[model samples]
Target: MDTMRDRFAPVVSRLLDEDPRVAVVLAEIGKDGFAEAMRRHPERVINVGIREQLLVGAAAGLALTGLRPIVHTFASFLVERPFEQVKLDFGHQNTGAVLVSAAASFDWPAGGYTHMAPGDVALLDTLDGWTVHVPGHPDEAETLLRRAVAAGDDKVYVRLSVQANRQGRAVDGERFLTVREGRSGVVVAVGPVLDAVLAATEGLDLTVLYATTVRPFDTAGLRRAVQGADTDVVLVEPYLTGTSTAAVSEALAEVPHRVLGLGVGRRELRRYGTVEEHVAAHGLDARSLRERIGGFVGAGRASVRA
Candidate 1:
């Protein structure tokens, strides 16, 4: 049950160990874990104090200087505290730096609202050159990280949860993982909600798509996948509707699709609970998903009888 951080550490460790040109930037919160991983390859670790803005700016500077830099920090701090810096310094300049956003969404309920970043994905997607990825499981996280690092020039934002061992089928070659067949009437989900969707529709004909890469979406693949099945499509995510879900809907305009966005509403998060509680409260749980699917398919009576 390795967390996204755990999955990322070894891949990053190997990258640093193999390539001297790659540098790892650690924010105040993620420094310990990143530092521990980079200990065996000490020369590559760049510990930047508590300044999220400066951390990203420094990573941009390093990238400009031809060193590949991976900036790590909590999602809220990474997006909010240094938004302008990220937009202008990295996004504008098209720096090849990668941002590994840890504790995205409600992953750290103990950290409270300030630490909870429900809008990070929304903010990042507006940027022109940046590619945003929200991996549902550890395997997807690792694959996305590898792709981000290998891209070399495109700015990448990776939203990762603190939870461990999420279930997702690995994608072939790319970070864009797919579960079920690439059939029509696909239900696209990000984060652990994919597991809920899979469990909810155990024997159904619906295609479940695990969108590991959120921004810079796989449009061609998506189009091909949904071309042959039912016209109805659903998109499930753990962030606000305007972010990933909106983007997906806009892309699927040719088809009859409905996006079932699940996340904290427009209001700020004011509750106290674990990630599971927050997800369930917002109707992102397995039971809730089953209810939604039943309603969507108009098979409530059949599901109830079974």
Candidate 2:
């Protein structure tokens, strides 16, 4: 499968070159690939070393100056390192800066606990005036990025992973694609696990909601989706049980909701392994997810179906 870099490089490069008002801040590590793309455009790029704080601050400043800035960085550095800067500079001031957080969750293996961001969803959800999106595939990523760039809203964070399946381009306006539709229950998923959800519910009657937008959630659409469902909804994410789960619960207050968060638990780092290994260790793999869904289905039948 093509990497997220391969999928987004062309589109991002075009946007940088075409939009004179756009500026890109590439992380020190992301510089090689992103910089090469920007070099093609020449005058639309900026570098901020390895200082995540400075990167965010600069992007916030650029936004204030009427320039659209896209800040690229590792998910951990983006969320933990420059958190205060993001909160005060962008969140407080409401700057129209787009944050592209790569290697979200455990996508970057052997990076260890220091670089692992298993709580980004929870952290960003706490802040107001921020739109958080975690695209499940490359096509969704492109669409979401384009929409964020065109959107007037400030403080947008896109949590990206390197595992997107680049099968084909997303259909127009397919950002919020409905993987399944059912009047009984809803299962919302983000990140690479979307494919897992699809596979798990191959013959189930439950609705599967592919929510690309994590924060500033589509409350209206979500509420409508779960309006008549008999059983409580289930939210799946690549993080701990907090943001995505809590948001759905709050949004569908009248209706019940359950969250099945999958990520590295808060603890010391262990042995080194690949991204898939880490995800599997923490029950984030497709098979584990399928079992969880099976349990939910069984319970739902007992409570609602029967």
RMSD of each: 3.8, 2.6
Separately for all candidates shown, the number of backbone clashes (residues 3 or more apart, or on different chains) is 1, 0
Q: Model 1, range 7-99, lDDT digits (tens) per residue?
A: 776788888878777789887776656666566767668787888888989898988988888888888888888999989988678776888
| TM, every model | 0.87, 0.89
lDDT of 1: 0.74
TM-score of 2: 0.89
Pick out the ten consecutive residues of candidate 1 with the lowest summed lDDT.
168-177
Query: How far off is model 1, as Cα RMSD?
Result: 3.8
Deviation of model 2 at 285, angstroms: 1.9
**Best lDDT among the predictions, by candidate number:** 1
Best by TM-score: 2
Error of 1 at 2 (Å): 1.6
In model 2, how large is the Cα lDDT of residue 199? Answer: 77
